[model samples]
Target: SLIVKAISRLGPVARTGGVRGPHGVRSEGAFLSPLLALLLLLLLNWLHPHPKALKCYKTDSEASNLTLEGCSPDKISCVLHFRIDKSTGARHRGLSNCWNLNDKCGIADCLYTPHSRIEDHGSCCCRTDGCNLMENLRLVTSPPTATTMPSKGGSSQGNRNSTSKSSSNDSGSEGGLFAKGGSDQAASVLLFSLAPVLAICVTVVLGFFLYTRHRERRKSRSESVGLASYPVDNHPFPVGHLSSHIRLKERLATGKFGCVYIGEDAETDQRVAVKVFPPQERGSWLVEQELYSLPEMSHPNILCFIGADQCGQGPDLRLWLVTEYHPLGSAHDYLAGHTVSWIQLLDLAESLSRGLAFLHESSSEKPAIAHRDIKSRNVLIRSDLSCCIADLGLAKKFFQGESIGDVHPQVGTRRYMSPEVLEGAMSFYKDSFLRVDVYSLGLVLWEMLTRCTDAYGAEGVPAYRLPFEAETGSSNPSLSQMQAAVVIERRRPEFPAECQSHQGLSYLRETICCCWDHVPEARLTAACVAERCKALRRLPVSVAAEEARRRQQEEQLADQQAPAVDLQLPQAAVINEASAAASAEELRPLREAEDAV
Candidate 1:
């Protein structure tokens, strides 16, 4: 029970501020009352109908045998009577109300019968309440017939009378219906004839615009290529001949695309890492160069880009990207040999986060970039123990309103791939790509923590192991193996229990967990991780201790400056008189000394 009480004190306690029994149900009614009232209010609102105003009968022919009584808040004035077929007496009646006055067409002319094959179709709309009633609709249903003639001479007279009557009927029934139809036909013919020409013109203009844009882009690419292909003499560093000017000392590492060598620039006597890419890997070399050459790409946390040059031709061609040589080499190499202290671990995490944050930042000069392949190997540690991010071959730039280019699905290292990337369900947005980098960063952080000697405490540092080495037992696990372990099984690199015992490491563990959340959106941004790392580096434990000590000192000084009181005084009056006399005597001496002077 004591242990339980002690553990319970670690977390927050919610204050209900009400009565509670042994089972905590005595105040149930208090909790339920407000909830019940809210539900009742919602139910009452749902049951109430909208207020009725001007009511009208509405029906559509398509929805047969269905009639709706619609009421508008705005007083309805117009009623429309439409007859689709006069012979069959098939009709639909509707009330036009200004429920939405902005969408309403005011005049009756706006509601007209469309030209149909049936000649008896007509509409008579009027602006009066209930004007579309059945009684008012009897005006045009039946017309008087022509009278018959008695004899052969009378037949001609009857024919003339019938013709006059028909003409009058036609005038009453919508004037010049055939003439209006003829005009409509003429307009439609003109539109049809010109539509093809307009479409062709638009298509031609669009094609021309796209073609010109493509040509301009191609020309720019060609110009850039021409500039890049210029002789080594044109370059700032001017490695006249790669073999003659640069002495390759030792092969540091080999990657899928290239091999890195610790080389000395013969002319300047400067140590540099020369990344030599074969002819087949020239594309990656070019991409790296382009990224490095971008404006505002320079940062302390980012590996310095010196220069790049191509030597030889055909199969013998070798592309060389020279960068500043760090004596400490990669974080992976450093960690493999030596276990870092907690401070060194924090520094490594912070520096790495800063580099990633810098790369992911967007400005007017450059678009944000994602270091798709962020791992221990890609992070280089300087002599000062601070790290810089390198190997940007798989890096991608994201501009506003533009999608990230479709990369080969399996471009990044299998171990560092995020859940979304592993499942091939990644959204090609800037944030999604950045989040992938963050997930990899989390794995790298785990790697740093595992390599910290202090993390294991008295048990001593654990043997260096790559992420998920326990599960897969291989440093280079296959894609399927990683998917099974990381995605299907949902296994993360084991955080040592000893590390979690420490406050700083515990906070860092939480950060790592948040960064590598299976849900990509739930992961923290690189900038956020960087800020957390920076905060961690500030050493909250020490800061808090210092603050407490300062506060204690302040309280002590305040106590010392406070006037003492004699609780054992014979009387309150005597104490007050003594204090007064003491104050007066102190003041009198100062006054006398001033007077003497």
Candidate 2:
């Protein structure tokens, strides 16, 4: 306070030079020199504020609030540092975030009310314009590169120049009494004219700096959270053991579950594919396979899992499941790598149907497993262009002690969710349980048919529209707008013109449409739908020929390699055998009944 008062008192003297008291003319000049000396000393102290100069301070708890009212050009922005103490709980952490205004509060059109709650982090920016402006701010700026001030000598020299210029201008106007007002007016006009241009440049540069700082802060925050939160596993896997378990020789596929390495077991010399789940999410891993997925068994078309190293939560905690390694990889991956003929598509359709049919049959220990999530990405292809289902996290069993009537209510994939699921009516009815999976299967078939279609037709659909459409209305939106139209207004997907041209494709398209019908009752069961797909198209000529035939013809070409030997079917096959027989019996009675009808 004392320093502030001293600086203010000296400001006028520094700007305006005057002689000392006239009574003592001899000593008047001496008095003027002392007063000028005092004025210069005060000016230096005023320009360099202590709070801003202390940039090296680690924390900013003591800093005063920002004062924009009488701010000079030099002190345009005030910045303070803060560190979150981890001893504080999660709620406290949230509050610290609020205090920092990391939620983008207190900016643009903010109402002056104080926010007191963590949940209200963005309360100050609740006004529509403020939120929009904040987004604009994020888009515009790069960040500041430096936080430190210029050297003391350079700063002092700048201050001196500023002080000298101000004194010179003031003395010139006052000494030339006749031209004083006109000169002052001219100077004021010049300063005013240049101010806008300078302000614009500064604003642009500052905005850019602020934006960059925000981005960097966000990145740093994310990294810090990941480091602090993700507990270090003493056992990260090496490339070799993981590859061997999955039977991955080369990486055929990599996904959220883990990498699918094409591998061969050294002991059995048997080729296999390995799927190792990440170290995280290990607790519920077995439950996912035994209860949710694999309890219900297989078909030739379903990619089979052999042996599993269900080592729980250690160096081997990464749940490694092995399966037959298909040399051709997945259907979607193959399409990406190379184009497929219509014949190949037919083969894929037939194979996937066979797999789905096996899943839908009710003879397994558990009720039939529903591959609730079906998409082109989950379809794997064999060397002969046959496809099979993979990834059953979203699957559910509905038969055993619990009936489909008792199935838990939940939806599957977003894009492939059945109308019933979207409408939140899944599991309400016994029949609708498997119907959801059937609907997803239909969506997968449609996706295969229109693989070349852009996510939505060319109409520029905004992001907000797509989810809403899919979630609600039955009527389809325009083709161009479909992709962007999410939410309750998602439009129905259609068959391609090329699909319509093929006679074999008409039944396939019709079957898909029926399966995806808005009404659950209208959709075909997976078994019936699979049969329909098989009835429509024959196996491609290339794929139908026996392996021996290919071997003889392509003696020069590599013989069709043996199917992956690692597929251990003792558990799955044993179960599948009993189920297949039972399924045949159940269908036999129904078939006899139908024949009599």
Candidate 3:
């Protein structure tokens, strides 16, 4: 203060010294020396100005990307977009609406980065072009005294104020730039995280599509094969060509393999039977074709194969098998002729034995042949009344010397199945034919002996009663005194008046019963049965008795078919003949009941 005063007073003296001479200059030097030193100290103080820290605390209105365009001509309008420290919500408003909104200045384009330091307030002001706006805009509490801030050079002070603000802003900008970069980095990280999952999802979808297409192709191929719904003629094979030049006459029968039509060849005009298989059932037909080609099928009792028709791409086509056509049908149909004589039954059994023996034994060129599914349906008759074995579809030809017991465990018709087969004890692949087919032959003999009596046809008859039912009754007896008519059950057959004199039928009865033993080893072999029948032929049996039975049976059947003419009744003669047949039919039910037990 003293130095400034001294200098102020020296101003007058310095002007006088220039007017007066070197003597006035020497007097003013004493007073100016202290002032000169003080002036030097003050100049250094100005060089290092006291640090002015102006904390521009941001209000809600100062943090937006605002512009001056929205302001009225008299006021500056600007917005602030920011959040307060520890506040739950953000603040946005026009800065122009603030108290003491400085008319000389405005702020524009200000924004805070997300997650910024809310403690540090920031603001910017845009000045009108001609106006010295925002100059001395500090939050000053008190106006400085004349000595505290020199009144001279007012614009220089304004310049000093602006320089301080510019420095502060430059420091704040470094933090804002860092915050902006961090926000961008977070977004990029999120995108990278999902890339692998999306790639895996796309790969899985493509793989499933390709797999489904492959399965569709395979299913289409299978549909062309053996679907049950397809018709016989609609098969992929050419039917017209397969049946070309074949002339059908009468229908023999319809079967699972298809229709069997009796026909004649157009070229040779020879009578033949055409067995056709339904398209979907071609598997059985294919098996038959292989059986026909077997080398051991030369037996006279077996049906002969003439030719075969194979048409289509795979083994699953319709088959038309050609063979010699006979006027007579299956044994079941032939046996429908009222009654079969014991002599006729013995002859049928002998023919069957010959055929079965040929199949069971091995020859030099071929192996043991098994007709696995032997049944009454497969036995055919000719016009000459000779029996033939047909339908060899289930036949299996094994190597010579191979045992039938070692074959697959289960196969063949259920009724004729041996006890070993029922128990699954026999393996055709392990045991010889004598152990397997011989047992079946016994059952076949039993069937021929019993025939299909009406009593048994009703579904619940024991097999043992069949023999006693065949007896001719010569007397009427009480029911309570009767025993099992078939003595094969280890029970005695009660004597009937009609059958008490059947002494000549004892050998044939013994032969049929021996074949039906429970144990396979105990059963008679087909060969043994055939030999016994041959022996029986040598016995001196009256032909007149057999002829009489046959004639009587035919007349009974004719009477049942249509009404008889009115004439004198031959009651006694008719009664004598019918007594035996009536007992046989009636005993069939009792025999079946015992077998079930």
* Per-residue accuracy of model 2 over 1-597 as CA lDDT, tens digit each: 433343353546544445545674444344344345443553333443222211111122343332212222222121222222336611110110011111112234322222222122221222122122222222112232111112112364553454345434554322121112323323333333444554565556556766887999976764333211322222233322434433346766676557767667666666777777776744334434453234445457777655445444466656665666777776656665554445566666667877877777776364566776777678887888788887775566655666444344554446566655655655454466677777777766665655422212233222322222443453344432332333255446645553442334554677778877777788777767656555444422322222223223434222334342224335434544554454344334434433442
What does candidate 1 score on TM? Answer: 0.55
Which candidate ranks first by lDDT, i.e. highest?
Answer: 1
lDDT of 1 by residue, 294-374 (tens): 888888999988777777877888888888899898988988899987778888998899899999999998889988999
lDDT of 1 at 174: 29
- Report the lDDT of model 1 for residue 153: 22
For model 2, where is the 10-residue window of minimal lDDT?
A: 92-101
Query: Alpha-carbon error at 503 in model 3, in Å?
Result: 4.3
TM-score per prediction, in order, is 0.55, 0.42, 0.43
Q: Which rank order by TM-score, best down to worst?
A: 1, 3, 2
The per-model lDDT (C-alpha) reads 0.65, 0.48, 0.49
**Model 2 bad stretches (over 4 Å):** 1-254, 291-296, 311-316, 364-366, 401-411, 451-490, 538-597
Q: In model 1, what lDDT does residue 457 have?
A: 42
Model 3 regions lying over 4 Å from their true place:
1-242, 248-250, 279-283, 311-316, 401-408, 429-436, 450-504, 543-597
| Per-residue C-alpha lDDT of model 3 across residues 1-597, encoded as one tens digit per residue | 433332343345433332334665445354445444444333433443322222232323333433323232222222232223346443323232211122212333232222233232323233332121123122223332111111122364563454344423444432121111223223223323433553455456546755876888866754443322222322222333536767777888986568898877677777778897767766566566656656656677787666667444455565677666767777756655434455666577778877777766776875767777666667787665557788877677777565443346456654444556655665446233355666566555555655523112224233333222333231322222122222223332232222223432444456555665556567676667777665545431443254345446546654753334233145535755665465454445534543442
Give residue 597's error in model 3 in angstroms.
Answer: 34
